[model samples]
Target: MKEQYMITHEPPNPVDYNNLRLEGGMSGKSREASEEGLKNSLFVVCVYDEETFIGMGRVIGDGGTFFQVVDIVVKPGYQGQGLGKLIMEHIMNFLEKHTYPDSYVSLIADGSADKLYKQFGFSYTYPKSRGMYRKY
Candidate 1:
């Protein structure tokens, strides 16, 4: 199989978002939720295998000052293929192109994925502050 894939920073399709998040064990997000969230997203990217979406990522927030990288996911079978890196590259590119000087870009790194995010200039906020979250 070929090892190359295309990256598109357009908004992801609702079905694609469902499949992408489902593969990451976050299937609880309904189509309604996906529709709403995607409508407000600042950026989204996906790595497709022909017609199938194998990976995806998104950024959510206001346009100029605040941005958060969210939902970076690759299918289990597609893991370890640098699809994560590809996704991050697209996300970083979007941030670079859209952000103004001194703008803040943030993401909550899950598991050991901090290493990947770090490659794109994301660092731990320890000593300054720690990331916090609430489960619904």
Candidate 2:
């Protein structure tokens, strides 16, 4: 049977976001943090299997010059179903429609996930620049 899912240009609720993240092998965030983050995102895309949130991705930045793709995740059971690509496609569409020529769009690809981002034109920056992050 073919599974049916709906993609929307909406941010998932805090609970759904955290649940999807955890189920997708990413760390969960506090409800407060998730709420704040979703509210601040420049753009968000969510995938649902009927009423069940199954995946999500969001773009965050100053809305100009610098935009980062974050929280790209799909539920474990839905991982191999091309939902990740669907999420990225929506994100890339937003970037294309809203970003300027000099804008710097980036993402920190974990593990083999870089391969997925590469299909959307993300390239390695290691030779000329390195990605660094700090956790508080």
Candidate 3:
């Protein structure tokens, strides 16, 4: 059966970050960091099919000068559908409404998803700038 879904800017809960294990690094963050991140973030999108959460995404950073899109995820069974696009469309829409004219909005596009993000005006910064990560 095709699932009907709704997207919301509010997180499922402040602690769902820990409860749902939605951390983006090698291992999930501690409950305190996760809670603080959510509380301080400017944007969050949670996708639900009826009552079951099928996906989520968020944007974090200083609201005025920099914004990074993070934690975009879809439940495994819901993969291959256009839900990622839907989730990202919301992210784009949020950026449209809130981003200052000269502010930068960015994401670390994964796997083949760069193609999808390109359609929304995202480009590779590889040659001009490299993306580096620090692991703890």
Ranking by lDDT: 2, 1, 3
lDDT tens digits, residue span 4-57, model 2: 788888788898888888888888799999999999999999988888888899
Candidate with the greatest lDDT versus the true structure: 2
- In model 3, which regions exceed 4 Å deviation? 1-3, 18-27
> Residue-wise lDDT of candidate 3 within 78-102, one digit each (tens)?
7678887888988889999998999
| Most accurate candidate by TM-score | 2
- Taking every candidate in turn, the Cα RMSD to the unseen true structure, in Å, is 1.8, 1.4, 2.6
Q: Which portions of model 1 show Cα errors greater than 4 Å?
A: 1-4
Score residue 90 of candidate 2 by CA lDDT: 94
lDDT, candidate 1, 18-117, per-residue tens: 8778778664577888899988898888788877778888999889889999999998898898888988988888888999997888888878899999
Judge candidate 1 against the unseen true structure and give its global Cα lDDT, from 0 to 1.
0.84
Q: Report, for every candidate in turn, its global Cα lDDT versus the true structure.
A: 0.84, 0.90, 0.79
Worst 10 residues of 2 by lDDT: 1-10
In model 2, the clashing pairs are none
Per-candidate total of colliding backbone pairs: 0, 0, 0
